[model samples]
Target: MSDVTVPPAPEGLPYVSVVVPVHNDTARLRLCLQALAAQDYPADRFEVWVVDNNSDDDPRPALPEDERFQLLRERRRGSYAARNRALPHARGEVFAFTDSDCLPHPDWLSSGVRALLREPRPDAVGGAIRIFFDHGTVPTSGPEHFEAINEFRQRKYVEEWSFAATANLFVDAPVLSRLGGFDATLQSGGDLDFGTRLGRAGGRLIYDDDTVVDHPARSTWRELGRKTVRVANGIADRSAHLGRRDALARAVNEGSGAVTIWLKVWRRNEPAPRRAVEKVRYAAAFAYVRLLRTGVHLGRFTRGR
Candidate 1:
């Protein structure tokens, strides 16, 4: 947690293009668009591109009528593809990314732009993501608690893994153009792959806690399980280029790691009786998702063989 004082953005701040990829999540997209519309950043300096990623329920009708917002359609199924489709039309010097389900803080754009313009500026910046339950709701389910604890570790992704989730990421336009955008083939882990590629290309990616977004936590066991499966499939996809032996070894390592995490969770201290019960539920949910992920990867390995 570096304590760097960011100066206030100048009146003539560099133009920023905010890109959001949406599928069938029109409800959340509306909220996301509303937040973007209300950003504290100058409306004249920032533009929003909402790329609808082939949703059966069209999101265009819900888009704001203001000139600052543009609705684009990407017939491609994946989010990365949708983003790529919108990239060519972006007019800003700096590009920011967030999912349709995420609500950016009022100062998100200002904070990100200010950080990018700071001395010894970073090539790309990853922002913070905080998980919140649905509107007018509290965390009442095991999956919700599990998500509350495990969702989008953005800081760790930036500092430890040298990557950032697209849920709250920013990159210079030229750098993004040089990198040729994300791998449209990857349904998941594309953000990690893109960040890794950027770093390997001598680009610096730093974590900024000031730029924040709120993501809705998974509310049910089924949603959590489905997301786990998608993650496992993404891991498998990434390993497709690896030797079979190495892929199997990686799967084994991940499966064992899950068990280790479960054990650690079991040993964690729970101060209150209610918290103890919630802890047990969270552990159970984690164990299930982990096992599900492992099984999916193993299946992928076998199918490849």
Candidate 2:
């Protein structure tokens, strides 16, 4: 997308309310706030609502002195619930969602807003999620390599699956309102439900590769394992609501996906010893995750409506 220089008048530009949800992550929240402060978008044209999702540590200190960054709190347990808490307070015509763990590019807001205002306007925009490692270290771990390659494919998610992770998504305020905001009950995959609802409602959604944010990849089995459970639970949780047939099909499909785990590692160009070890590690992790998912699906099935 070409650079559409912001006109001198603040009123002419898109007024965006950037909403972020934080848990017990004050350390990364500080970085997220700092990045938001440094955005190329006109400071006056955008406001950020960082909802402290019941953090044990006080994140208020991470809040900038500027009034543009409002600090709010939600007693809710899930991120989507916390996001719903900010809906009533959003003042922007557009709402941009990112996680506290992300470092949004300086042009993130501008590129997203610009894309939203294009000639054939889309009701929502899903941007690129660039994954990075901690401290610029050499990508050593198998979990890291697998996650870096597989995680956060926002464009593919938007085009094929009809949703983008909240880690980097921009949707119009009215469209969000029309859909009744995100599903607060979900432990994960609220973005999937919301985006799917948007498409079903005839809303236009598009992908803008330039609109990007850097998300840290899960480097350990522990971290990625938690994500796996959440993702599995999220998928089953949503699918269960659709009925037993759909839920069973989803479980089978995910179970079948285990075969592709080998392909991901095999496709990578790496040294032999390292590749072999990585493949084993990836297989182990995938199996562990599949086990967790299977358990969750069984529980959901047992508790069927």
Candidate 3:
């Protein structure tokens, strides 16, 4: 990891609210909080709000005991809902969001704030994400390798689709409030939906490559499959809102796109002979994930019908 130095904020720097929603992830949340505490940004200029989203385990103890770090509880089941619950209470001009399982670089907040203050300021900004596997150089499992490769495509989401993952997004407070926050009903894809809405409303969303966070790769196929289904369901839910014709059109588009992705994965060549086995493993994992996603989408379509 490259070293990040956060310089002192200029006078009149905007106060930032860093919001994180957590479910039953105590250990990972602690690590995330520790990283936040180590941020080189002016300590008094930023605050952290950790919303416990109906976690069975108490997350309070895991959080740092600092006035800047406040813990809020949201009885609602979804992360988006938790974020909504805390949105009204945020006392900052900018809102920086990240997942509890992510470890952000020390300069993450500083960079995001700077991006938001640029001349042609954007309504929202998304940062880069890097995946780290528990098992050193090679991934320990198929799901791990798959996640390592595809976890957060921040650049593509921002440039191509005008969306960004909430895992590392920064938004101006007024724009976020005006947009009425994320769709609370969504379990996944809420960030995408929010960004899309913002763009449609004449808001600009930019991608800043400097702000960075590290996310651990998913370790099991079951976990990966569950996430895949949740994401597919979120996408389907959005399509279903547009009526039957739109839903059908989305299905057709996605189906063709999936086929193209599969073909690319199958034909990808690994020039290094020693890493050939690793390449095969990645291809199989990618194919499996694509198939699972297709099945999940099909199930959603059937249920919608």
**Superposed Cα deviation of residue 177, candidate 1 (Å):** 0.7
lDDT for model 1 comes to: 0.84
Rank by lDDT (best first): 1, 2, 3
Off by over 4 Å in 2: 1-11, 135-138, 242-274, 302-305
Give the CA lDDT, 0 to 100, for residue 208 in model 1.
94
Specify the poorest-scoring 10-residue window by lDDT in model 1.
1-10
The better-scoring model by lDDT among 1 and 2 is 1
Provide the clash count, candidate 2: 0
- Residue 19 miss distance in model 2 (angstroms): 0.4
Clashing pairs in 2: none
Top of the candidates by lDDT: 1
lDDT of 1 by residue, 13-81 (tens): 878889999989999999999999999988778888999898989898778889889988988778999
For candidate 3, lDDT tens digit of each residue in 234-302?
777767666656655656665665455444554536221135565555656666666666665666566
Number of backbone-clashing residue pairs for each candidate, in the order shown: 0, 0, 0
lDDT on C-alpha atoms for all candidate structures: 0.84, 0.82, 0.81
Question: Candidate 2 at residue 190, lDDT?
Answer: 90
Query: What pairs collide in candidate 3?
Result: none
